[model samples]
Target: MRPVGCHNEVMTTEIAIIGAGIAGLSAASELAEHRGTGEGILVVEAERDAAIHTSSRSAQQLIPSYGPEPVLELTRWSIARLLEAGNYLAAPLAWPSSFVVAGSPEDVAAMTVPGLRTLEGAELFELCPELRVNPQRFRTAAVDESAVRTDGTALVAWHRERALAAGVEIRTNSRVTGARRAGDLWELTLGAAPPKTVRAATVVNAAGAWADEVGALFGAAPQGLRPLRRTAALVTLAEPMPPEHPMVDDAAEDWYYRPDAAGAMISLGEAEPSEPCDAQPHEGAVAGLIAMIERETSLRITGVVKAWTGLRTERPSDVPVCGWDPVAPGMFWLAGQGGYGFQTSSALARAAAELVLRGEVGDWLSPATRDALAPDGSPDQSATPR
Candidate 1:
């Protein structure tokens, strides 16, 4: 299949996917698995390389029970593939597990998610000895042991490369300009090598944080596209970093950290409001993270080796917005993975692909979900959250 705009006289396919991030790549891969070599998958990526945005910038971790039950369910569905010793990946992704520790009496309570139990103070520290308690920040603590530390960045690259190898056309630097319905198919315009247009019956908007902005081309409005800014700091220590250090969350999310190659990578986990632009680490955020680490543990506050920021897009309900838009037929949305994207990518992508490619969904969802999640109905269905 040709990209939206490739002057090269190539073939067209059944589907066109926008945004070659994890969601886009996963969708393309999933579609190909169902269709096989008979049809190719076309993926238009705005960036030059895969995972240049939040997909790659994230401090990779695989935490199945690190979020809400729905998020945990998504993570559990994807955990098999994530933990598989070998699969269709360019590089091995099977890595050791990681942990996510919750701080403060309130924050630990907040971490006591539904359908999952939070580890006690002793259990939390037992998993990771480096974690220290502070009288000031936390009156209590809890641990989510299912938080296995893995390289999600590697998994992202692996997914992209595998999708490319599967006869999937990955057009990098090809920012999608417009998407319009032409007859029964979609005529997509792109800003890439020698402007061109590709036609497909279906279009999947997996454009990461820019999902809503991209969906608008197909007559979609910015509804639940809430992109929150999250900052990260790459600081190296004088001694070898503890490889076994479980990822830790500070009280009130003021600061959080994970070990990376003998160095501790930290974040304030701040969901600051920001515009949809190239994000840079906020000085105040980094400073706050350092202060939290210093206050909680024996670690000293050294200068940040490097700092950067990325948007963690989420819906109003803070859940992934998968399936298709009700108003826009043949237009599917797999955005709003938020910080849980890496952990829940596989299952969410599969569930969405199934709904798009095959029109059948399990009746296991509640009555509210059946009404609220049906793509044929209005997204405004049901006054309560599904």
Candidate 2:
């Protein structure tokens, strides 16, 4: 899960994107494809690299039928599009071997979120041979065909390269100073040389953790966008694990871990309410990861190679705030992807594009996109779903 080369030269486009996370990068690629021009989308990011924040530091996994119902639906639609999005994935998107073990009876019971199954103690051992299933302590195990281990950084670079090919200019290190409605166009003052002014008919705010602060400059309300901190660490493996080691996670999602080339990456998987900004990995969270790993497996983690935290922007209802806003008509709200950005990128960008161009609102949206982005469905399609 690594990139091959460097970025392209600085250029401008018709649509100016605010950030370059998966959401922003995906939007750029879509806008570039839709525009079908050499240069019609310019993405302005504050970070020096494309995905220096949450997009890079994520414990990449595609867990469909997980999270909430609406999010799962989004994940379903996203994975479908991701399959055919032409180079949006790292390698080919493959469903890797995964395991979700339940220790306490309470933990086993938590697995049933409708359409989910709990396995026997013997089956848990069969699913993952290395894992120890204490029938006395741990009750059951859950396995499914939907859990897909992913490489998020590779996915980001994939979209980035595609966007570049489509002439979607991504100017990193160029922070947006201000954005306001000047007549019918958006006047974006960037922090570049002589303060370059970008004028576009539409603007997408995808500033990741800094989404709220950026939206406010353009008269877009905070809309309850909270950038929470999630801490993750990469520990050196004591022994090389098997090829098919399932990722061990919980229902409440207290902690999770996956095997990587370097080692295993463990996540505290916390969503702490914090101020909107670049978040750092908490010290206590690191300790908590070690403890969680110990509880899950007997493997003792003595050396930690590296650790970092990223801010996942969330909205009031936990679902992303996609599409246009009530306050800003032409201005689009593409923020609040939370931790599911990479997995949900394909659907989110498709939703945004359909809303922006054709004013088409599909059933796949979270209802928020329908309310603000498109009132009328596409003229060709039926009003109600078949």
Candidate with maximal lDDT: 2
State the local distance difference test value for candidate 1.
0.69
> Tens digits of per-residue lDDT for model 2 on 204-282?
8888888878878888656677878888888876775554677876544557776777777788878888886677877
Query: Please, what is the whole-model Cα lDDT of each candidate in the order they appear?
Result: 0.69, 0.70
Q: Cα RMSDs of all predictions?
A: 4.7, 6.7
Quickly count the clashes in candidate 2.
Answer: 4
Question: In order, how many clashes per candidate?
Answer: 6, 4
TM-score of model 2 vs. true structure: 0.86
Error of 1 at 151 (Å): 1.3
Model 2 worst lDDT run, 10 consecutive residues: 375-384
> Can you tell me which runs of candidate 1 are displaced by over 4 Å?
1-11, 85-92, 114-133, 301-303, 362-386
> What digit string (tens of lDDT, one per residue) describes model 1 on residues 1-386?
76675564333667788887778887777667766641557888888876778876687876775665577677766777776744655555656555554566667666655444465556655654445445444445655556665576667766676676778888788788877787888888776667668787778888887888987888864556778999888887655456766677665654677777637888877888777667888658777777767766766645678889999988775677776676666777788888888888877677666676665445434344333333333544322121
